[model samples]
Target: MQSFAKPRALEPLRPLAVHLPSMSYVDVKMRWKKDASFDAVPVLSRARDLRPLVSLARLLSPSPTPVSVVSKLRSSLETPDRRVTSFLRRFPAAFVESVGPEHNLPWFRLPDAAVHLLREERDVFAAGRADVTGRLRRLVLMCPRRRLPLRVAQGMLWHLGIPEDYFKDPDHDIAQDGFRILTSGDGVTCQDDDGRELGLIGDGKGKEMPLSVLQLNAMRKFGSVAKVPVPLFQSKGLRLKRKIQDWLEGFQRLPYVSPYEDFSHINPGSDVSDKRAVGVLHELLSLFVTCSAERRRLLCLRKHLGLPQKFHLVFERHPHVFYLLLKEKTCYVVLKEAYMAGGDTAIEEHPMLKVRKKYIELMEQSQEIIRCRRNRKPIELQSMVSCSGDIEDCTEILS
Candidate 1:
């Protein structure tokens, strides 16, 4: 039978004014090194309830003058190390319910057994450490096909005390395989391996970023409310991951904070085609092609700078946010319409936005290109505030 020692001895829970990461919630399972020569040793791991910690601790009780069998037990559990973390590792009820009926080894018994063996002596623990990868690999064979975020898997590793080197190690294929087995697909199309794959996938779009992560846990619905789904390509049943990667191909994302924006850089008093605007235009010119990721970043930057919200639809209903490229200057305003409207004028000749790098270079590099660029912008040549009736109302006096 297994049981946790008197947990009441631990300090009573008090409200901590400070915020702590969720990982800190789990118990710190530490095992003393088997080697007696070492003055003290502490092995930090998250796999707490799963290891043999409780069983071994019980054996190390102050009672020394017991039967020969109890002496053997003490010999097995005694450690040279006095320093230990002060947290009890307990199995979650959910895990307890899941495997209680099927395996006697479930509900952290295996983990406990492993910890007990570790404290038995140095050699035994060393052997188990070497076999850890193969054992984890076998566990992977039974992994669920559902794709989960690395965060959840990492959290599991920490809670389980799998070992820092195991999960941190790129060479440790077990943890990598475990990650793949656990979290393995687009948010939309995945079969949950176990019932525990909750709060893992992103907003059923591309890139498995948990929505809570997106809003920084400030609001529940910010990312979903703002998701502008874009058509990636003509491929069959577009993949969310591929689509997100394709979207990020063009633009870079700025931080979400408002202070990150520098509006002072804009020459507010100058002509529309001032240096700052020109610089923004040049950045637009530098883009090899239109992409959704960059478009999202453009919107985010605008919001960060307290600029107006801009979302452009590339296709029907597939809106992307971007700086309107119609003007030679990069408009602080976002284009809220489709880039290419399928019309006769949207032919191979007259275009809404100039896409040619050579032409933009000509405008930026020489006088001819500058003339072409200036002519292309309607606002540059056309008066935005023209009074139409006043022009026609002129009393005819010229013969």
Candidate 2:
């Protein structure tokens, strides 16, 4: 024992390499199906070119405005002065063109019908001021800082049912209601004062929150919120492959996350994070009057909503909940449940949409005027030709 060699130093123990199962699911690429009903939503175009007519009408509400002034107000190069003038001319029922006496330039004004429609729209907006403010507040609350830039808010004016004039003096009534406008070097930002979070599920003050489309369907089908809601396909024959369907079933089984809840704890590439992204998008479209928006417009809110860099892929991945329409080279994302079975009518039509329909009806008159003018041209030319022939014959006889 005295002669025993010194015990060799124990080999350093190595930690085991634990391999965690990947929670990420493969994004199965599904073919997009065109739903005529969703495509029928008004102002589906990317540029929403027709909507500018409303703004033009408002600009001329005080008096006839020159094209030069309208051109200057155009912020996007997509809608040039020529396009604006042409669009205004197409809607003769809404816009009236006249020559200015002093400048001798074209001036556009809204007709009586359009003026009445605008007044009706104002009444609708006034009556729904509380609702509008609620939507704007929800949007601000969705942001990480509980604030939204003035430009971002303005970009979503149409979707949020906010009036353009609201920005000019936001501090008046809009800001007085649990909101404040702050100016910094970055620019103006609208911040929430109360700072309460909102969600599609759960309760507040013992009152249950409004359920989402999927939640409502789940309640209707399973008679409980715990079960997975079956997706409503765009068409009758539309069906997902076995693997895709299985993946969707698993996805639906994940605990639903409220869009307004904090997402910091969620793993970025996991299924839960994907579910939260879908929730955020669903909540966003639900707030829109049309329950749809241009894909590009939603891109601006990606960072504000805590979405991933490739967030738009959610729309394509979950085709059952959302429908992506590529019309006029513009991508529009539509909520499937918002529309009726036929997709022609909305389940819950906004009050503003009724007035908008009236404006659209007025706009149709312009096409009729063009058709009449086109049809009358042939008769007028024929009459002129006959008259010229008679004159020539009379001259020959006189000679």
Candidate 3:
């Protein structure tokens, strides 16, 4: 695997000599730069990492026997760290541990209440498959590469409302052979003018499907990036706004520069060119930050947008427009205007938000189950569970 930066950084500065931490050897790297940020990067609390494990546990809950969680997780999880057992141990209430009868190794299984949440999740999935598929189809179409990594799809499962079983379902896989879709993993290439991979031909099973005129038009439009406008309200100085407008207008008059085009000839440090590059990045980020925050390091764009190692510095320079939260050792670059009063993202009451509310409910249900099992008394989770208020009143119904 290629080396990339971890979303979170090591905290309190652990010594490398005294003793190596168990989790330290894990592949926590993201597909982005590894350098420490100019600003302090925050470490994610243990709870944050545990959430992924919860989803993983649910995926594995159907097994009749307590299967070795590590062996099963290798395929399911992006990175099965050495700290897997340690992380699982942290959540005894959520997952039950036992020795595998056949393998004589430790195994984990979800409790009954957690399974109930899983059942509810399945119901939600059944109800939302059409919407999720539509969203996924649109996402695939929007991708400059026309294919996304399976790992990325899995990571966005909650927000996308994509079922965990999507890959298993031939109808749902984005790269179904009959659909003339090429999966990202396939070593196929479409040579652009600069010899960069730009388009997908199809699955290797049959004759290459040619791109339509409309599809070609879409590709052209995708390359045509818009300019970022300066915030007029924030600029108290009228002269400043006028200066920005003039600068932007002048910048627009220059020949359109495709990000994929070679920038090696251009001096990267030149203020005029650098300013243009910054605006390009801002415009690119605006497209994705429509729902929530995006990673400041932007690993996904590194190759696609031809960004440099220190590209994050651009967002850092424009602090007013981009708020960089050094959370989870990764910089979450959020648009300043996208946030509401309570720090929640402004997604306009999207269905994805509603799905996430169910996730919150799952966590609550799991906790309540643990509480009841331990205390031997009924544990009420009505107050703990949340609803997006789009469907129904969770408080009244649950109460």
lDDT of 3 by residue, 195-278 (tens): 233222352224333332222333454542343233311212213345555544554344433332335565444444444455
Q: Candidate 2 lDDT, tens digit per residue, 211-237?
A: 554565567667877764435554645
Candidate number with greatest lDDT: 2
Badly placed stretches (over 4 Å) of model 1 are 1-126, 129-131, 146-148, 158-161, 170-399
The sequence of per-residue lDDT tens digits that candidate 1 reaches over residues 1-399 is 878776666686767745443212111122211222111111111111222333333333332212223234433333222212111112211011123334442222222222323334233323454333322222222123223334334433322224434545576554333333333343343334343332222212353322211232224323342432211222223333454554334222211221112345433432211222222322221221221112333432332222322212221122122222212222222222123322311112211112121112212222332344457731122111112211122221111
Model with the higher TM-score, candidate 2 or 3: 2
Best by TM-score: 2
Every model's TM-score:
0.16, 0.77, 0.50
Error of 3 at 228 (Å): 6.7
Q: How does each model score on lDDT?
A: 0.27, 0.66, 0.45
